[model samples]
Target: MIPITMIPRSEVQKIEKPGWVLVFGRRKTGKTYMLRHMVRHENYFFVTRGGLILEHEEQLLYPVFEERIKNLLLKDITVVVDEFQRLPEKFLDLLHYHSPDSRAKLILVGSSFSVARKLMERRSPLLGIVRPVKVGLIRPVDLIRGLFKLGISPELLLRIAPYIRDPWIMRFVNPGKFRRSDVIEAIRFNVPALIGEVFSEEDRVLTDRYELIIRALSLGNSTPGEVAGYISGFIERGLRSQDVKSYLANLLRMGIASRTQLAGRKRYLYSIESPLIDLFYYLDTKLGYYEIDVPMEELENLASVKEGTYFERFVVDLIASLYGARVQRSLDPEIDGILVKKGRIVAAIEVKMGDIAREEIIKFLERAPKEGEKIVVAREGPSLEGVSLLTHRDILSMAMNFEQRF
Candidate 1:
């Protein structure tokens, strides 16, 4: 399996100090894989998930940890506790107590909501001492490079294949002899062809859930209520208490969908992650048609809105990931995106799917702090007053820029 953890593994090598480091990300995003890969040669213990060892008012889970510290006497030796949040709160105290003069490092990895709340919220033991590492999904670059490393042909890679959003589709298809049956089987099963290395249990669950969600999203149900109804109906024929919120939260954590709330109504639009899914939802399917297939022109028009929205979301995710630990995303009425660095608002972006007037741009720009940069992002060529206007192409280019910059 390809070790994508090499990126953080290289970064960890540069840290000589014996300080604590917390590696966190949504479940199935490869946090544990990175942690284990980084400390392979070092003395490390993999703690059981959702399990903890504790004593009265203290955590002795690391009972032999002190002994290992003296025995190793090495700067790079580290201990990793997978699913650290599943353990009781005392686990943090144990790590801190033994960290005074030892060269041993602590690597904590867990999923979203639980771990993020503990490490980032005020009054967290992990606060101020731990460095946060976030792992996102396989990027297009990573996919291309990973496939090449596996000796897959470039010609096969360039095929105008249906975007495979599901994992089960990889099971039956061979390298050559692609056919309509294969595509139908894939659509029926909802599995993608290529697997991002480092498959985990949580990853499988997410892949299945995303398959269901994308199907619902393809049926003209983009809003939370619509998606929720579809999923709830699909799962058990009825929606349970908090079923919508629970499934939506899980999908967001898995990077399958994203949420953005509109004005006056607290309702959010839960968009599918893949443009292929969007195309399947809008372009391929027709509603109550007179037995005629959608034409190229109709397909293109249907695709425009979904593609535009996907592009906007791509820009938001790019900025959020690249400038991570520096920026925060908010869905305010006027602002489509927000950037906060060092806990202060530094920039705001308004997303426009198509041509928009300068007056709307001004209203959106008003939401940003006067001291920070204000910009409008759109598909059409940009125009705005006193604010930087950037096109969809420019917005994507900015992601690479931030990748190189701070």
Candidate 2:
């Protein structure tokens, strides 16, 4: 087994505080791992799908567990409940009842945001008592450091880093032994299983429409109007831009898609947030939905496109993550990435699959913020005046360097 390094998350400090913490994020973002690292074995309780049955260790049924916890002398004890959403409604009610006066700190780890929201809604018994901490994908810097520690070369790390953003997927990525087939199998089976559960259980009403919108966005239909146009072709009725907007809003809320706006531009561009979702959509389309077999040539073509797109997005997100920047999109010159900080443009970036030329750099610089930094990230690029040039290896090194400092 490859030993995994734990990335230092700021939220771990918050978990140490004395209050109810509702940890919310998508599955496999390390919610359980972080909790297990911080909370003692005796203090933690994991609620499985088998309901409240007590198993090995200190597992307990809700009724008996509730009585035991309530009767225990209040000390510095921290009670951690993993998959707290799976517990019965009464168990949550008990937590709500005890939250105000209970001496023990309660840490409830939930995989589904919708379920967590329901428990913490205004009318719910836990309202105003729980502090929400969202566990996002591990930072790029930390992920690079961990993979390097596991013997993955920087080159291989850059190659696979884009697709395996979720740490759960990293377990399957063995540097020398990994292959594209492994990625396809992982996406084919895991993406639907994880994302499907969230949509079916939480957003069941418009799940079909949600999938359609995400598919459209994954296919490069970035604008709201473009996505609406693409989706309208299949549905019975013509989709109004407003209706499409509403669906996009829902996607954003569920963390499936993200919206970006240019610095001074009002138009918003939508993109699928999860790399797994993007890969699934790409392969699903290339293989012809519901079809089992995919031609090798077509698969290669899809992989090429996936690599290009993922690399561009990775570079943009890496820069944003490093500098605490907000990514934006602009038309008319079609800049690839815009970084903003404190409402001011800090950098303009262009990501390319091939080498960038002097003229191309000059063109991008012309459209970029005059006083801000201009960057061109490509597979191969010659040095140009008045621009920062970065290759994929350079990016990996930059992220690794940041991790060392952290």
Candidate 3:
């Protein structure tokens, strides 16, 4: 087995201080893994699907668990409750009441954004007492480092990184050993389990509509009108743009999807937040619900086409994150990514899966702000006058350099 280091997250440092800390992220973003690394195993309480685990072996009942927490806090121990959302609101109230007097620091970790939002609502017991920290996707530099440690080639890593963005998935992947059959196997074995765990609670309230919206968005129907129009074709009832907008809003709140708007444009484009989730939807669409057995070659062909677009989006988002930039879609010249910083256009970026021509680079540069940088990110690209050309290797190096500074 390859050794991997816990990429020191900034939030972990905050946990050392006193008071209540609420750490949240979608499942497998490394919330529990990071917390377990930072705190002692005995100090951590892992909440399984069955419910809360107390004192390693014993399962503590609800109200009784509250008393146990109070007693733990009185002892001035740093307590970590993983998936704290599984507990009742009364448990939170208990923690809130005891927090001020006790020396113990409370760290509550949750995977579901909806649950976290409800817990931190204006009327909820955890509203004022807790500090929220989101555990998102791993940094590009850290991801690169981990893959390198696993003996994955730079070229292969770039090709596969887009599909397996989550560290939880990436850690298990071996590029050297990967085959076309592995894609189908992963989708067949892994995707269902992840969907079941993450969306089971959501399914209770959302029904099939949520899956329909996801399918629509994954198919490139980004606007509210486009989503409603596409979804209308499938469902029996008439669906309005407003209904799609409301569903998109719920997705945004749930941290499953995000909305992007251009600097001057009024229209917003909606897309799923997690690349892994997007890949899942893409595969689902290709294979369909009833198809039990798909040929490996067919799955490979479909994945190749979908992964090209995924790679571009991954590159754009990684660049944006590095520069602390907001992504904007430009209309006139049709730039792939507009990087804005402090309300000014810092860079205009064009992402291509293959090598970009000199003329194409010049055209993009002409549309970009004169004072701002113009960049073209591709697999292989030639140098152009006044334009920054970055290859997959160059991007990884940039991220590595940035990680060193951090």
What TM-score, computed on C-alpha atoms, does each candidate reach? 0.48, 0.88, 0.89
TM-score ranking from best to worst?
3, 2, 1
RMSD of 3: 2.8
Query: Candidate 3, residue 121: CA error in Å?
Result: 2.2
- Model 3, residue 223: C-alpha shift (Å): 1.0
Q: Model 3 over residues 259-318: C-alpha lDDT tens digits?
A: 888656778889887666776677778686325666667776876776776677777877
Q: Ten-residue segment with the worst summed lDDT in candidate 3?
A: 1-10
Which of the predicted structures, 1 or 2, would earn the higher lDDT when compared with the native? 2
Which runs of model 1 end up more than 4 angstroms from their true locations?
1-18, 26-70, 73-101, 110-133, 137-214, 217-222, 231-237, 240-242, 253-257, 263-267, 272-306, 317-387, 391-406
True lDDT of residue 343, candidate 3: 80
Task: Report how far off residue 313 is in candidate 2 (Å).
Answer: 1.3
The deviation in Å at residue 202 for candidate 3 is: 4.4
RMSD of 2: 2.9
List residue ranges in candidate 3 displaced over 4 A: 1-18, 38-42, 49-52, 62-64, 202-206, 369-371, 403-406
Query: What is the descending lDDT order?
Result: 2, 3, 1
Give model 1's TM-score versus the native structure: 0.48
Candidate 3 residue 210 C-alpha distance from true site, Å:
1.7
Candidate 1 residues 141-161, lDDT tens each? 233333344343333432311
Please list the Cα RMSD from the true structure of every candidate, rounded to 1 decimal place. Answer: 10.0, 2.9, 2.8
Badly placed stretches (over 4 Å) of model 2 are 1-14, 37-42, 53-59, 71-73, 151-153, 203-207, 403-406
Per-residue C-alpha lDDT of model 2 across residues 123-193, encoded as one tens digit per residue = 98888888888877666665666566656555566667676566667666565666776676667777777
